[model samples]
Target: MLGHEERYDVLKRSLAREARGFTLIELAITLTVMTVLILMVVPSFTGWLNNSKVRSVAEALQNGLRAAQAEAIRRSHQTAFVLTSATPAPNTVASTSGSGSNWYIQVLPVYVGETLDPNPMVQSGSFGNLAPNVKVTASPATASLVCFNSMGRLVANSDATTSTNFGTTCTAPTGNITYDVTLTGATHPLRVLVGLGGQVRMCDTTRVLSTSAPDGCP
Candidate 1:
């Protein structure tokens, strides 16, 4: 029942009311909720990232060991997988190590021509330089060097078990010898074990090995 001009004025006021934005209180509440959500998600995401990094390094180390074992069998020559420090860039591929760099893999043909080559080494693969934050460490400490002969048998370290060299008889060490390469991060660690039987496996050290069935370390 209103006139046209009054109706137009009412419509303008309604539109103006509808166009108003949120108040400071409403914005503050929304920001608080978003902040809480982000805070909750960030820690879990960080933990998952750390766990993934550690797992990747562990798998890489395990793969390096397996590759060396396979190469020893395939070439019918003694091969060694050594954990050494990373070389600097541009010379990254060079199989040299320094005392300060992170862990890296150097695969060497331990012997050739029925004698230990003066520089019996061929660069197989490298790690650690790319993953500086992750730490690759050994349990026995002396496991930094491990070798497999032409027979695919693990060469024993002199400190832990029987000692033998390339072009010499490889004696199997007594019992089930295990060298644990642990990849540690901010939250968790992954353990990769190399056995005398030429087996490489990854295990979760947080759980019991024997009692936890398939979920435990081997």
Candidate 2:
């Protein structure tokens, strides 16, 4: 019953409604809200990422230390856990460094004339390439090598061989040898503790070690 003009007008209006979209103001407001949300989340995400790196490095170091201790007990020989920047090899001398990013464990020559084991290298690991931003600091600052006796307890050693040599004298830890792993943007730094009794553990640096706070470091 409608005329041609009315039909045309109705069809155009329907098309206009179908083609409607957000205006410039609405689009800009939506983008601004998204930007603010991203800004708010970025710092928290960065902190979490850095903390995860710290934890990974700490756990790796702890596992390495434990492996060294277990090897010493298994072989009934003195084993040296040395932190060095040197690439670990079967019979290469590893130059020790307190904050070394790599760790090497080897059975030490006990006696002056003792024949070095054919394969002295027990285990090796690298955290440098994995988490370069994570910094490791030993408690004594100069203690880079920890030796374990046949009993799997911390011991003093001045062992040296063409294959492996602990650059510094391995001194028994008075209490616990702590390796603190930290990252620049991390809110929670972690510590790897090696006790005199050969106990290795990782703990949070911000808390006190107790029954309720087992994750805390002393």
Candidate 3:
């Protein structure tokens, strides 16, 4: 008794209603796929954020060092990069948040840059911080002191660790970093450590990175 158009409309609506319902298995499969995607994405995002932070901080230090070196050469005067940890003594890079344990680099107040007072030309450069979970444990070489002298070279005054001139990164006490800044919460930092020798080396608190020519920066 229905007209052709009315019947066609009824059939279309019936199909639409049927299509709106999905089986439990199909729904579960879709959810599972989404869960897998989320799991894969979250960790990668986290790692990316951490690595970017570290790299940025490292590059900043390198830039500062390069600037200091260039300034020394330009003025024919020794320019130094004064170094210090953000925290005080017993300042373990581990206990403090990464946002707190970053290093500070600044021109030594002693050298004047066309200025009268020591600090007139001085400006402090800062790095954002380690992963809040990461910490730096000083060995013996980098404990009490870290400085880039006027000769545009590194100076280590830590009583604990010592460094040697092996033509590269710290090799022994003559080369080892007294303070080992390792990642605390995780297992990665132990694989690498930085020293005050101006050498950004990676090792097991023993063999350090080469501080030779490549060290013109950090």
Best by lDDT: 2
As a TM-score, model 3 comes out at 0.52
lDDT of each: 0.57, 0.84, 0.42
Candidate 1 runs further than 4 Å off? 1-11, 86-120, 129-132, 157-185, 210-213
For each of the candidates, the C-alpha root-mean-square deviation to the true structure, in angstroms, is 5.6, 2.5, 9.4
Q: How big is the positional error of residue 191 in model 2, measured in Å on the Cα after superposition?
A: 0.8
| TM per candidate | 0.70, 0.89, 0.52
- CA error at residue 183 for candidate 2, angstroms: 1.4
Q: What local lDDT score does residue 136 receive in model 2, on the 0 to 100 scale? A: 90
List the candidate numbers ranked by TM-score, top first.
2, 1, 3
**What value of lDDT does candidate 1 attain over all alpha carbons?**
0.57
Report the lDDT of model 2 for residue 28. Answer: 100
Clashing pairs in 1: none
- Candidate order by lDDT, highest to lowest? 2, 1, 3
The best candidate in terms of TM-score = 2
Tens-digit lDDT track of model 1 for 56-166: 767777787787788788877666665656442322332322111233322343433244434434444455443556666554444555667667678852322212222
> For model 3, how does the per-residue alpha-carbon lDDT over 16-126 read when each residue is reduced to its tens digit?
998888789999999999999999998877766654554454455445546655554455443333334443222121122222344433333232223323332233455
Candidate 3 CA-lDDT value: 0.42
